[model samples]
Target: MGKLVDGIWQQAGYDTDNNEGRFVRWDSSFRDSVETDPDARYPAEPGRYRLYVSLACPWAHRTLIVRALKGLEEAIPVSIVDPYMGEQGWSFSDGRDCIPDPLFGARHLHELYVRAKPDYSGRVTVPVLWDRRHGSIVNNESADLLRMLNRAFDAYANRDLHDLYPAERREQIDAVNARVYDQVNNGVYKAGFASTQAAYDEAVGELFCALDWLETHLKGRDWLVGEQLSEADIRLFTTLIRFDAVYHGHFKCNLRRIKDYARLEAYLERLYAIPQIGSTVNFRHIKQHYYSSHRQINPSGIVPAGPILPFL
Candidate 1:
């Protein structure tokens, strides 16, 4: 909910006052990559990097799916933060699936940011790629983290998957990902967190427009970009997976549900059927975080029941 400014942690709430009360997400700051080079400062080595994530976050969930699909579970260890983010932001808990920071033994995730750069100033988000060898964060952006894991550690990966960003497919993949991110992925957030009616209406309109486009586009296509699965599909899946359960009612993105879209719903099931993808989703975590953390949206802090998603 806060960001580090000039390498200093500043406690500030979401800035919805700008753009006529619309919530504009800030771009992630940490964007370094860990390539495969023996002499590099942070090489692609097994057990050298750890992922810090929150199960509730769709962005962080992207890395989790990639980690599972690529069979990098053993290669890169992960630590799950508590579902509910407090004023201090994401914190570690003794709950199941939540792992304490093995590298720094820190209680709060902000501590990791401070350790990485004492003067670090940015929104502390997840899935952070922590470099244990260098004792700093390699990257915190989920899009960058997913690509890094897709091929960066191929030497230690169980499967030798080809380039997800294939030469011929890069253009299409990029285009689709951009549309989805703006309309569906981040769109729900804009609508839910908007402080004015105009902002909410604009965002909701764009969201359904994009969803309608996808519903038609996916009529015969199995994947978003290529004939085979790609990162674009993974990006879309995380948001769609949460749409009906959390986004629909909790976030007030109720124009239509993912379940209402035949192609999108089936597409979700197809991805869920993938060997390890389903295991990465935690509905309980996803629900707890959004309902509890965003107190401004739901002041009572009461988590809802009954929207029994088939996936769960």
Candidate 2:
């Protein structure tokens, strides 16, 4: 949860003190793209890029889902960080399904950010698109990574891949993504980290309001955008999948469980049934990270074991 300063890892948490108890997520600094054009700084190529991800992170999970759907596992390998974010944020561990950083064998994720830019100062986030050839990060923004992964490696991706962001449905997809990202995907964090009751109430209120809308909107549809699955669904799915397990309790997003919404529950189960999507979720990591990482929220660090998921 800490950030880097002048390329040095700084052990400090979010400063809601200055923001009226509302949590404001910082923008991801690395925004370079990997394209099909060979002349581009980061051209799409098999075995040339890697992903640094945390299975527990919803933002990181988006890239993983896209990579799986595209069948880009072989094209772009991944390194999974430890579930717990301790004094050192997102470190590499030898156990617990954690994959160490193979490129530099760095013990912590911040080191990689420093390697990418020596003077970089920001939060070291996951789902980082790393340029192995260039020895730097191509991008860390999940939204950017999702689009790139969808088309950049088309030549190498699975032929049966879904065009997640089709040209015809882009307007629809973007509209849904904007609301869902702000209200649902990020609302949980906003509510959980809010230091004041007003901030928490505001976030939680908008969160369930959006969920209510989604429940109604998804009643007769199979996906969020158009007829087929799109980036919008993928983005929302990551947050929904974790709602009951982590967000509902850990983040105090407890007004309603996804199961409470019949349509949303069925929708979640339908999406999780996809082998490509289902395989990327790791509840163990998901539960572990949320319960343990936020000491201010859950000082006891006790992970709950009940609320058996209906989808699984």
Give TM per candidate: 0.97, 0.99
Predict model 1's lDDT versus the native: 0.88
Per-residue accuracy of model 1 over 2-86 as CA lDDT, tens digit each: 6677666667998888678999998887889988888887789999899999999999999998888788999999999999898
**Root-mean-square deviation of each candidate, in angstroms?**
1.3, 0.8
Top TM-score prediction, candidate number: 2
> What would you estimate as the lDDT of candidate 2?
0.92
- For model 1, the run of ten residues with the poorest summed lDDT: 1-10
Query: What shift in Å separates residue 261 of candidate 2 from its native position after superposition?
Result: 0.1
Instruction: Please provide, for model 2 over 161-226, each residue's C-alpha lDDT reduced to its tens digit, 9 standing for 90 to 100.
Output: 778999999998999999998999999999999999999999999999999999999878999988
